[model samples]
Target: MAETFERLPEAAETGGWLVRDEEAVAAQRGVVWELIKQVGQNLTQGVSLTSVTLPITISEPRSYLEMVADGWCYAPIYLKQAAVEADPVERMKNVITFAIAGLSNTCVVKKPFNPIVGETMEGLFADGTQIFCEQVSHHPPVTNWQVLGPGEMFHFYGSGELCASFRANSVKGHQEGIHCIDFALDGGTIIYGLPEVWVRGVMWGDRIIEYDGLMTFHDPKNKIIAEVKINPEVGGWFSWKKKLPTDYIGGDIFKYTSDPSKDRSSVSKISGSWMGCVLFDDKRYWSIKDDCPKFELIPADDPLPSDSRYREDVSYLKAGDMEPATEWKAKLEDLQRAEAKIRKNYCQEKGINYVPV
Candidate 1:
């Protein structure tokens, strides 16, 4: 542990966050290689960056709570709508629109903080809504969350899986999950998931994240489906600085009467930006920007001993205390790594199988 922390000065020194072109590539790769050797054990396959090779300085230490919480920031937007508006069809439209508002946060490439397994987060809304999230697995990592709203509003339970790959210049992630939200009022639920994620131009300067792939939503009861696909525009050689269409996050959406495979009729086309407005049937539907709320950050003083939010290092990081943050972070990661080995052994001894689901 001491030896790994000793490399921090070098990692920070080699972290060329400001350089460009080959020079930047050289510096970024330099740090990456050192991290691979110093902090990473099995560079291939499942490994949690929260306690591994991720650089202390650049890594976003937000947590699974913050990442998934982005979707609920605008809770009232849909929750309020779901409360009233008795018409079943109208309610269904609002539900889909509500889900769309949640995904609106996915239009950009800010890396979320990784979560340690067993971490949990919960929040309450004035409207009597309760939101909770938990990091359930570390290998083939999975995060689960639920939202229960007031006055016969809705019940939502979702789980997300993050699978990633490495390349010379960047990292890519594929999000796989068929999470759903149930509104018994309409006897419907919307099931959906995200697309492939790319940390583009990682070797150029500060890494940029771009999400490209197909995002789909389906409602088994309502027999309706929605699709959102993000595709990158072409770029030429020496296009390091050239922006791609994916960067813009402009994509078309199609709402079908049912699953496209089974029923492709009654399709309504929507073309627009995921971060902004989209043209739908000659009208425009806007995306969420600041209309959401930040997750209630658990205060250090109020956290239970077991809460990840209260970990000394995380507290210091949030408070802008760099020295303690670094020290505690290193110790915490070390502790987690050791605990993982013990858990693995215990599982084997007890003949218990930890399932991803």
Candidate 2:
């Protein structure tokens, strides 16, 4: 008797829509498959079984479409899995377990286990048996996966709750300085009758190298399933030092000038005639017009110069010095009399009274 088998919809006609561009869809599928294969190979080579768990859960079925002249159809299905572990030694194992589980689940839903692809059909096995399986039928299709951001370069993806929280914090520009990782699993077909599984993990070291616009994920049905608009909030750490001039001055000297010729020599000179008259009058010409000698000669009998009265005036102008008696006595008396007369006049004019305190 011949063995029975179920036939899957061709990769180009898995979905109802007719694929117009078959070559493009095939190319995309090929890229996706290559990435999935690389990831699987890395997991198998890097992970050890003693310290890690297996058969981790994955979320979201990967799907793509083949465009036809009239419509489109779903293609072969792709799947993804992710996991996290603090210990470096067990992290690879965790990732591998999830990847294997994802592959096995895809096969169980789409086709029977083919021993030719290294899939086994053992009813029951004793403990400590290590089974290795390979599948030639597994082909992953690729799609564009873009990262959007204005925050730290890294991210992580896990369970729905955790992803929601991380996304919220990242949008707010409050995500801590940790790496982010994102896995995009996409293919050309949708498997029927399988419950959508929940996927969650700790992703590290993900960054946005270039962002054209918003981030989006589409299923094979051409429906927009997930979208995150790009509104990059600003955040970072920075420092600066105070800048000061190398030299500083305390006060302006121009305000204290007393003589224009001597004081203003430091400034540029301005020369011009005012009202149509020349300003440069020679000393010789002025003396001749005034009928006076050009220079005066002092007489020998001149009295010794005495400034006793002006001495007190000079002292008062000096801001903080005692006035001489002979110079300041008369001035003080006159000031007192003036004050008395002003007070009497003010009292009489106002017709008001006040006792001296």
Candidate 3:
């Protein structure tokens, strides 16, 4: 079996997210089938998949903390527009575009490394927007992140918790947490949550990734809101249909009152593919095909010791050293358990409830 398979490129192309050869695909399918057999016996409704340790062959080089940073890679493009726009409705449109831009980065299907407690990552977006993230908890893993746009145009901060379950041949993940963006001007605050993620054909068939759910953006102070529904690429088990476009999203932005359900009069219609261009009322607003700026992480002069960039397992994988990477990954898990025991003892002695530091 080939330990090294082609990694996903930053942008999507005609072929697909992964450019794996036939040999690699066959090798992965064999290992994945064995894993499914082992997990099948314990499977019930909503059984947690976190306890299953995936081999290095199917894992990506980056950590989960760094993956979260990918969601804000295009902050410079849309968030900047929202910060300066005077009209509240137009500003809300920009915010929605920014939210959708992150979807493009999720095209990669490989699983990232699970972050250890105290793991941290810091970097800058293309527009010099600074971002800092930390793994605040281990059990039912949670991460807290903050992004400060250049010139203080906007502040983005949130805590995200993801729980995934093995269901049939697919893995479904539910993202729990609220994401907020506060504009420096009178744009007030915009709050929203992420859509559910599904990894289909885990054990057989062609592997396809999809994000499906309704996302609502609210700016109560400005009396405006937006609802975007992500369309999945493939139909459910009983429905047979041609594959849909990847990252297709559509919705409406409109004015609302105390109860948004009462008013559906859309001020601007949103339609487009998240991987390509987003349209507002039949006009193009954001496009990946155009010369859109890409994300580049600015090197930190004095990064913390716990930074994800310094992880042994990730570094080994990046260097194409599979054996060491897999070994270090196991060692890290054991280290995390020992550290958790120490923390629990200290907290018990102090007579205080344990809280993420």
Candidate 4:
């Protein structure tokens, strides 16, 4: 269950954490203010992240670590797959259900803080499931994560690489990564491809997110293949829609044969919104009615240096204090930059290598 917080600010106060000039109050026009002015100003040679300054808005804020880890909140579903059924078809269905469950994070619209390299997070679940993650690289902006989930029944791990660039009037994020599910049931492993993301309306309209890409699940041992398509956000200029709408993802799973020449019509079909119930073989395959199960946050008694809870900016945001949140968030980034320099110099003096992960 998600912890409840204070209500969002009044409309006149802000517009979803956007900024025009770091004003404690919302920009004059609020959401109507063109993001292009802010995003475009930062455009130096191409598209730099800090061309235009913003009048920070505090809406919903969460650290990048928590955002990435949230994807695995439904990992407990693997517990049900511990013992495979005698029938191969039933076993394959289980894989499809679990695969989709892991994508429950797609429903979230807010963006997370980009993690700094070498930052790591560790936690212990009440049920003895161990979880760990780290920002392994920075040049390519990569993150690696793992979960020893459901009483150690399976190992879930993956790495995500974010490569972003500026286009004519939009920012595109290409997520190059793969995730896997390793089961103790039959030593079967299924793999999933990451999705691509984009933030539109940044040029002259209200900023909103769009998701597009493919999610593939392959079980090498059983020769089962599941392909789920993630559709792009619907709408364009002159549209009232300002959020990524839920789109249906349906695909076919072939049994035994990965033959390119064979017809894919006879394979099992699964389709639905990534945020809601997926229909498979004309039946509901899987759905996450809520965000996810509870996650272990920074304990009041003990917290890691890189823990999200320890970040003053985020703490202020959670309490619905936008002014302090915005001020501290900027300071937090500056501090990270300074600290990175210190670490680099130390390594140079000691002739030691920096740990990427």
Candidate 5:
């Protein structure tokens, strides 16, 4: 049986523990506001804010690569179940449920450290799931990652290029990447796309993370697709009419026909809040309130030189050494910039265009 725990109060949900300290919140907000104000003076609304330097006051004590790897905490359970499910649509149900569960693991109020190029992370989850990630590029920042479920039950791999644009009170994130999973069952490959994320209340209102838009899960071998709509908060005033769950997601699994105009038959319905419970065809599949498992990075005996665990900024932050953490963060960013310049110059001298491997 899975254990259950009460959710944190609204303050934790909005600001996380980092912002609950009034003085710290005030100091952090002041810094964030200054950055926003500077951007307002010089940049357009949708311009990339990658160059905006943020203090360590708002950082989570982990690299973005590690954060992404930890998102698959529930994969061991779901992928194992998916491998044994006879029906293709049911297998997809398990897969999509795993996908939604990943979202909950990643929806944090604080930002994680952007991975430095050539940085790598390898860890094993408590459930024997092994994961690896590498920061393959710096410009446009991309990371390549792969996960292997326990006993080779499943394989999940992808490259992620997360981009964000800052607004007066929010940041909109575009998750550009295709993710794929291969399970033990025959023809059990699922390819999927991610939804956009909106981190609201950065400057004024209560800070919250919301996933918007649709994620499509495609099983080409079975000619089936599942379209999930996540937290539709559009249409300003009219949004109130829906009155849905805070993290509501609704989707339908259907078999695709060769004729584009032909109507397709629905195989099953998926309804639930990604942050909490998920139901497939009215049957509960997963629930965070009941079984919100977490991934722990097992200590490696022989760590790589480029491992995120060796990063001084992240280590200091985890140890609650704020001043040193901030200093190391700045030093690392400067080092990354210098290394990028060297790489650019070398590519120019070689008459070759720089490309992420």
Candidate 6:
């Protein structure tokens, strides 16, 4: 069984408290809440910003001296500045209102354990215009200690009403393994407002991840545009490799060479691991040396092989001239039909719906 915790009021106005004698914890939560609110305020003004929330949950054994920090942190500005441009009244009302509601229940966990570290999972959903998000983190503690402070904040647009629910739970025992889940949802609509767009925000360490809603413009005079449904799932595993610095070389291939004016350079100087894959068009072309390979046309109506023969055929095609556009188009159609058939067969086999976009 999991131990349940009550949802704290918005930390922005009334300061929140969970564990007693933890003034620092409460202050941290309050600051985070205010930051979330600020982000919401900026969004309404057509500003796209990214933020991070760290260590949503924490637990551990008093003897181990092992600390586990698990929570949401992301590092990418999700929405474009152009997505929110509209009348100031409508934008402010919608953006600020949405941020307060959206940041309502984000979870942060920080605990100390041994040998095993903690993990987190996060996701977002959009029902046409409305957007929602959830984050979860868990840890096992050795000594009995009450959870002190945990807080979260979600942000969205103000054109819709804010009706979201938040929850968090924890448990411990001799058994091993930690589980956590978080969710957020926004619903309602505006009769005469700007077009709807779905937006989701996430935080992972110093990185911020966002799934900005898709837009389709329709009217030029009214500047009417509709945002499509967006479902984005963002999470990361705790690993030591993440701490290591990458050795990637910058700029195009020419920048690393001895001569800037030369069109052809020595290929051997390009020192990096090379992986090859086949490209599909009218015909198959296998990539070699990260450059365009030769092209050959395959019979469009023929069945694609299930064995290594597919790679062999691709290699053979790349040894020839580029396939004609007419042949390529026909082949593409055949490939699409084959894909549809495969999907249908798999859905029937698994007793699932065949929903394709």
RMSD of 5: 4.5
Clashes of 1: 0
Give one digit per residue, the lDDT tens place, for model 6 in 1-357: 111112233111111212332443444445545655855543233332111222222221110211111111110011111124344223222222222112212222222212111111112222122122111111112211111111222222211121111111111111112211111222112212211222211111121111122212122222222222122111111112222111110111111223234433311111110012111111112223334322211222333232111322223333442244234424544564576578779999999986641
Who wins the lDDT comparison?
Answer: 3
Alpha-carbon runs more than 4 Å astray in model 2? 1-84, 108-141, 146-357
Q: Candidate 3: global Cα-lDDT?
A: 0.75
Instruction: Order candidates by lDDT, high to low.
Output: 3, 5, 4, 1, 6, 2
Residue 90 in candidate 6, Cα distance off native in Å: 1.0
* Collision pairs in model 3: none
| Candidates 1 and 3, the one with greater TM-score | 3
Model 6: how far is 9 from its true place, Å?
Answer: 5.2
Tens digits of per-residue lDDT, candidate 2, 1-357, equal 111111122111111112233443344344434533755544323232122211111101111110000000000010111212233212222222222112111211111111111111111012111111121121111111112111212122211110111221011111111112332222222111111121111121211111112222222222212221221121110012322111100110111134422432211111111101111111111111222111111112332232111224333434433334324434643554465567667887998682221
lDDT of 4: 0.57
Higher-ranked by TM-score: 1 or 5: 5
| Number of clashing pairs per prediction, in order | 0, 30, 0, 11, 0, 37
**Over the stretch 1-357, how does candidate 5's per-residue lDDT look in tens digits?**
112212334323322212244454466568876775776644437768655678888788999988886567777778778877888888899889888877766766567898898999988777888888999887688889888887777888999888898765677887699999987758579999889877766666555667778888988888888888875443321223535444666767889786312556778877766666677766778865565566666755676899999999999999999999999999998898888788778899999997632
Report residue 321 deviation for candidate 1 (angstroms). 2.6
**Each candidate: what lDDT?**
0.55, 0.20, 0.75, 0.57, 0.74, 0.23
Could you estimate the TM-score for every candidate? 0.71, 0.14, 0.86, 0.68, 0.86, 0.17
* lDDT tens digits, residue span 1-357, model 1: 000111111111322112224544555566667776765635433343433445445434566565665656555666457546565434444554554445545433334556667777666665567777778877667888887877647787888887776655567677678767677565566677766666546544455445566667676665656665554343321123444334232222333464555556534543444433333443443343334443433333354445556667667777888788888767866776687888778888999984432
lDDT-wise, the better of 2 and 3 is: 3
lDDT, residue 259, candidate 4:
59
